[model samples]
Target: MNLWTVQTLVPLPVLVPLFAAGLALALHRHERAQRFISVAALSVAVAAAAGLVVAAHDGPVVNDLGGWAAPVGVNLVADPLAALMLLISSIMLLCVLLYSMAQGIADGDGRTVPAARGAEELRRTLQAQDADADESGRRDVLPVAIFHPTFLILAAGVADAFLAGDLFNLYVGFEILLAASYVLLTLGGTSERIRAGSVYVVVALLSSIVFLLAVGLVYAATGTVNMAQLAERLPDIDPGVRLGIQTMLLLAFGIKAAIFPLSAWLPDSYPTAPAPVTAVFAGLLTKVGVYAILRTQTMLFPHDEKLEAVLLVLALATMLVGILGAVAQDDVKRLLSFTLVSHIGYMIFGVALATEASTAAAIFYVVHHITVQTALFLVVGLIERRAGTTSLERLGGLATMAPGLAVLFFVPAMNLAGIPPLSGFLGKVGLLEAGVVDGSVLAWILVVGSVVTSLLTLYAVIRAWNKAFWQPCPDERSLPARAPIPLGMIGPTAALVAVGVSLTVLAGPLWKYAERAAVMVMDGSTYVEAVFPDGAPRGTGESNEVQDETEGSTP
Candidate 1:
């Protein structure tokens, strides 16, 4: 009954997956063992995150590492916003892992005879594929040996990023996920993955460098990287310098989040990876960047109205440009990728408004998008599995061949398009409501852009639906003959779709939670109090009384 009493489970979500990653590495050769570790680790993570979400609904719970308070040592925070994201992410990660395990039956069958057709057939069946060619579709592909551990590491990174109470730790979390992601992106090291990996690595490293520099400047200006401490100091810093720091940070995060001006790299790199990898990336990675922007911008610089104007303009541009690109694409994955970029504008719109209603709606929208978008990508993966190609020009007639696949695709597709009675529609409505609630000139402009983008998104999804499932398969001889989807793949996709539907079903409770989270972001004193029992203790060089909440030191 007392959610606030559940304060100490914060770090377990981050730590368990890390420990599991190591265990998974030790058992990589045993695919069955790896599956057990992956599932168990993620299942525990989801439990931890869910408990935290229930607890965070009351307020934030700070778990100071070594029992040391902020501005001195690390702390894991489970604010409503962070906990909500973590819960959703953990659930998605678990489902995707199951999907990967089922789809990833790696290495050949249990027989070993050099050049034997059975072994060779098994190898080709599990061989990782390079999706570089536009028309060339899905294939049996990539290293299952390393998948479990690498994926678990990525999961840890995601948890770390959400739970981190300071900027440096957040950056570390981003790096953790990024490093693991490099392996996933290039799974099985196909030529296409190699080329795609190169571009991804270069862009990611460059963004990290910018983020590092921004952190340095923020420290130089404010003398602390703790978000709560920065909140108190940022108001006093020179406006020009603060603005500069904000721009640099946003540019870096924007690039990572694939916000319009800096979004070109995404469609190119994401579509080249294997479907599951692409699904997870599409689902989680960019959102981390959006989460960062949400955290830093709202928590650090909440009052700068001038900066708000700039963000509003960028939001409008991001929405319009991104959807327009989506409309122009002939490939389903690329179209989805572009739509992903466009929707970030909606979140940014809420961020720009800086009002409680707007922020809450934005937070709610993020959760909805994460679920729907991920489910859609998972369905796309299934499509490739059944049809062999993602190219709209090369795909069709699946409505009959795999009616189940069509239903799986249809729900998320409608949700993504903001069709009525779907989570997508509710999310867009919330954002629109936020914009209307704001009623400023720029907010109104963003409102128009948001609506148009949604309409365009529906068009794009319909186009994809028509080409991929409704229409007859083009060049039937080009693809390997029709095959039934694995229960593993279909089951996970269905689970996620159900999860997305649940968002609409539970929209009221979820929105209420988002409201609670937005309040925490707006008022930093509560967090400061929660983390450090004593008031503002930055640069004191003396240990303030850290809240004795967590179980112990993190390994």
Candidate 2:
């Protein structure tokens, strides 16, 4: 591509949604216009993401803002991994938009008659009362609405996070997304949602603070906040100082990723959001954490072998504990949220391995998990809508009533469980192969953990299927009548399922791209060069003094 075209490509993915969000806010009075703008923006973003991926096949695409060169101005670098993530985020956003549209249409239809009757009753009641207590007094009693322009703004924030070139910019992007999420999470202000969102907000804010501190320290130490420059300079930094900065960054991202010990907040917060919001969060947020961790480990501290054992142990623990949590949850959304935490361990396992093959596997797993996880959550949403509850006790005979939804749920559920001919299976196989190739005790532990987690995941999915679909509906006559599934809802659900199936069918090319992405990440020279054409000053590998001291003195 020409330079102008290359420059325009990176920004389009972010700008399209951002402009759409602005338009959506302006047109909020007209919900139809807002929906059209949101969908159109996401569609354009998806197309841009696909183009970026295709362009990245040849090499990385670096877009410098304001025509300034890297190391002087910010650069948006689109490597294969970044492109793949953008693609996954686009797909999930598209599905969420469709689902939300369906929900809005359904609510509008069902609420109109009741709303009119209620208004009439209120008018008559007011007419019999004092003239001073008029319609204005009751205007404040309007029902809370969920679907809004804020959701589109949230989408823009996520896109910005994926495409950001500098640490400070990433932080800004994260804050935007987090603020939007807080609103989305607590929408309608139900007691449970408020309680959950309060905890989520505190935890997320704490993590953001930690990240801010790391960014400040890194900039102070290295005189730059650009990730690519840091990668170039970090290796040459004082080992002690380097270790401390790296550890802080990792810790902050770990909290975000919900890695084992820090993961408690995710399960508590995620299931409380609206279905589309929950689906998007389950698919994108934690993975962003993983992306940060991947960047830190591979780019900034590649030679820090001291943390390898700790990462391995934590990965194992995370997997086991998360899967166990999944087993214990009776609610479909909560179960899936816990499972999301468990799967992050698998990604961390690959990062700890720090080999090209392992990283490739991690990349593959990330893509596969995003699609499967989001689709599963959407399916859970469908189940809740149809059955009027997501509790295992309340859901059943979906296979009989909604065969289409059953197929939609079953395919992704089985794939997530690592069934054959699916992308999940391919991902697990790739991870296992990487572990076996490494041939170390840690690798063996990871391999075993992968297998056990897969089995537990399988069990959890099967249990959900049995309780929610296979078994007879309890008190069938008493249960609510089955509602017709909206076309808007089915449209997105079908799109995501199709994407997952396509991933399975096209595993070869996709895996190759992932492998290439992994190789690119493992060898940081290309990325460094892309950011700093004339070669920036290198770090002295002694940046984090305290961490180095701890590592040096540790038994």
- Candidate 2 structure, TM-score to reference: 0.90
| Pairs with steric clashes in candidate 1 | 127-141, 127-142, 128-141, 128-142, 396-473, 397-471
Please give each candidate's TM-score.
0.90, 0.90
lDDT of 1 by residue, 1-555 (tens): 453456558887888999999998886556678788889999999998988988777678888788677878888888988999999999999988877766655223421111111233334534322333235553322254677788899999999999889888988998998899998887756577699899998999989999899999988887788877777778777889999999899988888888878888888888877677788899889989989989988888886789889889999998999899999999888899999888888889888888888888889888988888889888887776677667888888989888898898889888888998877788788788888987889988888888899999889998988988888667767665444467867898899999999999998888888888999888777777776667765431112223222324434
Tell me the spans in candidate 1 whose CA falls farther than 4 Å from its real position: 1-5, 106-143, 481-483, 538-555
Whole-structure CA lDDT of model 1: 0.81
Worst 10-residue stretch by lDDT in candidate 1? 110-119
Model 1 / residue 475 / CA error / Å: 3.7
Best by lDDT: 1
Q: What would the per-residue lDDT of candidate 2 be over residues 61-155, giving only the tens digit for each residue?
A: 88887888766776778888888899888878887777877765765522111111122332343343334344766322222222455677787
lDDT of 1 at 93: 92
